[model samples]
Target: DGVNYCTISLNQHIPQYCGSCWAHGATSALADRIKIARGAKGADVQLSVQHMLNCGNVGSCHGGTVDGPYQWIYKLGKRTGSGISYFTSQPYLACSSESRDGICKNADTSCKAENIARTCSTFGEPCVGLSEYPNATISDYGSIMGKNAMMKEIYNRGPISCGIDANPLLKYTTGVIRGWSLMQDHVVSVVGWGTDPEEGLYWIVRNSWGEYWGENGYVRVKSGALALERSCTWAVPDTYTAPEKNNEIHCYEGGENCKVSAKDESTAAAPATRKPELWKRDEVERRGFQWRGNSSTPSSHELLFTPSNGFPETFSWCDKDGKSYCTVSVNQHIPQYCGSCWAQGSMSALADRIKIARKAEGIDIQLSVQHLMNCGTAGTCQGGEPNAAYQWLKEISDKTGSGISYTTGQPYLACSKDSDAGFCKGVDFSCTAENVQRTCATFGKKCVGMAKYPNATVAKYGSIQGKDAMMKEIFNRGPIACNVDAVPILNYTGGIVTAKSKDTDHSISVVGWGTDDKLGFYWQVRNSWGEYWGEQGYFRVQSGALALEQDSCIWATPKDFTAPERVNLLHCYEDGSNCAAAVSATELVVCVIERPFAGSPACLRSPASGSSGMIGSMFQAGWGVCLERSVARTWESFKKPENHANNWEEAVSFWAVSFAHELAHFESPLHDRQHGRAMEMSQRAVLPGLARVLSKPWGSAVGSQNVVHRKWTLQGSGGNLLG
Candidate 1:
């Protein structure tokens, strides 16, 4: 035989009992090939097996087939580097038993797992390290059947992955095992083939188990034995260039680039001359007062009125002077393309009003465009009306205390790089529903735990008919929702846009107005295409142009809106006894626990008052009384006291004492006097009530009488008190 040489072999060990032999075997072979193709000049690249195990589309920790690893590499590509870390980069926790089966479990057909295998200086630092191997992909891959073919591939391409019967090789030592049953259940790589004087012919196979298990991490197996070469695969690497370091600042105006077209409808020439039409006052009232026109008319608002007496010459909710009254700036419609302008327009305007109503306190709230997009009855991505979105918001707000959430809570998901029409045509409505449902559930849980603004309603909404009226409304409120012919907006980059059309197909917000000597009078408008587009998510349109004030420009008044009042309450409990309390301006809730609060530290420390708790201990904060429940059968003793006690006395004692203590802290002149005076005042106010309750014949007989009295003294801080 003339062929006996093999490329210098590379070996790897997938530590622990991970069932990701498929990932290890395939990535190891590919890494070896990449090294050989690069002339083996630098350190051998160790492709991440853990990366494939955690982030790949292949099976999980349980054993998987070689085909899946190859398919994942061919599809999503692979990252070449060491094990970054557990979970943060590459997770390698393996099932202790063989009961777990390996299969891709992600719901979506596409693999959307975040890439976490890049090198980093710190364990969880967001930055990917420089030492990480360059990104690489398998250009082409094919199976090599038969022993000679597998051996030939190894000889030519450094190493080839092949399926093997792992049972007979489990306890393998130094020497080659001659014959074993051919049942392939695991995968390994054949790095070389050689003939021994005593063993005859053998294949040098690499194992994923650490070096301590076999002959320095490798095994010399009898050629063709144990189905070692029954099936094998070889792949060729594609030309790869290391990606440029991404150092660009991710501003609100930076995101996926919008496509520009030469024949973009937004910038196309206007049709031959057309006359503007004006609706009569009665007709406008009947049709919801939406404007539809291309050119100006005597009846038009711009022609019929002047700015309100106090309207500002220039104003924007989002201005460079740091006086932005609007909550959110830019947003995107992505993942799937959706025609959701109606939803975006209404939600954006409403969010601005909410910010204005709250006087821009704390962080700006970006209302959920996705809420209206998925739950509203207006229309799907095909197209919709802003009025329907508003009506839907009103109805939902009445039904659910929280009608919409912020962008961080619900986020826009439907995205398309193409036109709104194209996006709607290609979307899967069912999938969109699933995405919204899953996100909303999480939002509901977190929202209830925080101090949320009261649910708001649209008290009054009307179309702004004229330019003066629109500007006045915006100045008085915050922003106004309006319809515009969006054909020219598709290609808008910057500066004043003066294009006009009779057909208004999109809804947007008119945030403020300004004057530009060269570009003429314009309105600062916000688009839902995200901040990366236009001037940091905003653009300017010539005032009274583009049907901006046509058929309907609407503004709403927020009703029943109230801000959350700041309040603090303390819970004091015995070392082992479970007693908890939450105090807000409107309510106080007390709970006696049978078990530990199984929630986050913050939730446990300050549990929301209305949330469900143990039966007898659960009551609204407005009850103005404290509840004491026991885990054992000691309730009969307490029930007897309630029968003879004046309920009003208890309410007076509890709230008067609590309020006195809170006020002492609020009005205290010295830090040391805050807690002490508050507690003393509280105890003094309730002393008479406490004396009456303790004087009861049953209370005197109970051994726990002293405990109840001690509870009141320790009320200001966390402690165990009698009672």
Candidate 2:
């Protein structure tokens, strides 16, 4: 049974599937599409086909030569599945015999009684549709290696006979689905091979099981051809003459109406259809950097999600490795390739999350990559509520939104699953808060005679009163939010104490007391170690008396709130007094803000210089001096390698910080009493970028003089950058 193995090898190489083989005929190509062919039982067996045949006794070969030469037809193969049968003729191949004079003689053997081999290949392909091929061509097909190997292999790769066409009628063309491999004595046609950098070669061949296989899903090829050549099968095609439209064709197993070519006997090389050119239609590049596969391979349960209402805000994390990287741009409804590709890089991925959180109820949040970075900073105040975001979120949300519906002020924060180990990448805020004492904890304020403001609290003095006596100097200056807790105060009373004071021990301490609205709001006042103070140390007066007597105040609400302003001042004395009657009056302001920085030294500043009016001077002078001092210290801090940053991104961050410290001084005349000696320049806009030329090696990192911020940003920075 002569079979066309060449046609089988023509169809097996693509990325999708593999072609397995059964009754051996030198298993060659890969099987792509799989389908049901025939056979009732499913088991494993081997089939043996006769490899040689005597064609009218031309002993050495065919071609009407000596004694009707004997020739090689198809080989045998072993396969797994049900039963077995031998295959007959298929039209995809053709054969021509060579005379002793080396002439390939074509016989009048076209299956359809015509001269051309149309059914062998689509058109413009090799000759086909015949039973006996010259032994030389058959033997030559075996020496080939891989897709890129020897010249013999190169000969098998032209005309791509294996790709799946759109035609539904060409089903069995792929072979595996046809169950033709099940035949015991059957050998079939050849297809193609696989040469992906990964898996090598599989096979593709045909059978007599109608057109059910449609070219795929039936056989298996020897994995790498290492030891299974004995299982190879082969075939030959009979050229069909009458052509039919592809749509009108049916599942015919043997419509072999084709013919062999006259040129088969030359043994000369076939002309290649292409030539190398400098210009190419495809691009090639090096791919060495992929240490791992380009994409991440997460665990099975890993899923990407767009948080409920907090899309991009709430990111789902499935760890492929131990590190915490965020896939913030996930889309919950569709797989990543649909209306959703990984949404990253652009502003939409992050900013959108923030806008979403703003609309949600419960908590106010800001969750951006930057937000994550902020919360993760070794330096953020967290609105003075240290270590509280998580707990605060817990408190705000109703259980319905507990897991995630709770919102945020900023949505695009780089987020990952909250691990039990804690977000290891962030700063330990709880620890930082507990250690606040290490950063600043010394409450020691001092006052004498009379303070400038009404809300003064002397560690030693209570609200003293009367003319030129020890009690008169007690309540003077306004309270100081200027220092850390306004502690360590100096009391100026040298009088006796009484019972109500509880011996907090001071010549003049307010100690503590009850307020009576109807009784003029009394203050339980205490006095010095001398006189017989009210029962061991104190006495009470109307609540309103404290305000009138010493300039005390009410606790103020937030600026936009409806509560009354605390410490609302009523000037004690003014400019209408006669010269002889003029007594000194002190002006004090109790502020609600804490000192901005812990160690920024305090200064007793006057109104700024060069300002035209008294009001302007008062507004700027005292503050300007303090800021000048702060700028110098910041410059010094940037000198060390550990602190000297080179990037503009980081430089801008520092600029904001430095500006903040300066604003602190501009607004409050006395505060943060700590680093005055470090002054170099008065403000960020004023500090020269890249310190003085001569001091580069020894001096601090000063800012650029020409880089003042924009008017808007400047306005917020204590309103200075503009003019």
Candidate 1, residues 1-723: lDDT per residue as tens digits? 222122212212111124566766777677767756654322223454555654565675556777777777766653532222112122232322222211112112222222332211111222221222234567778887787788678777778888888777655656686676567887887778788898889988877543223453467888768888678877776543211222111111111121122123243332333221122344434544333321113323334333456666678875524444654443333322355666777777987787667655432345656545555555455456676556556566677644554443233444321222312332323212122321111111221112232234555555566677777777767788887776576556577888876767677888899989887678888876543345545678897677887657766666543222222111111010121222222122111221212221112222333333321122333121222221111223223344326353453355445544444533454788766765665565334334433433231144443424322222223322223
lDDT of 2 by residue, 1-723 (tens): 111112111111100011211212232221111000101011001111111111212121221211011122212111111111111121111122222110112122222311211121111232233322111112212222232332233233321111111122222222122111221222233344443344444543332111112222123232333222222322222111111111111111111211233234433222322111111112111211111111223411123232354312111111112211111111111000010001111111122222222221111111222222223221121111111221222222223121111011111211221211111122121211111101000112110111111111101111112211111111111110000100011121122211121111111223223434444333333221111112221234433232223321111001110001222221211110110111110111101011223322232212221122222333455544454455456544433334424443344446435544454454445665312411322232223322211112112223432332211122333422222
- The reply for model 2, stretches above 4 Å from the true place, is 1-186, 195-201, 214-228, 231-723
Kindly provide the TM-score of model 1 when superposed on the true structure, using C-alpha atoms. 0.38
Predicted model with the maximum lDDT: 1
Regions of model 1 farther than 4 Å from truth: 1-310, 330-332, 398-402, 406-409, 415-456, 560-563, 566-723
Worst ten in a row by lDDT for model 2: 332-341
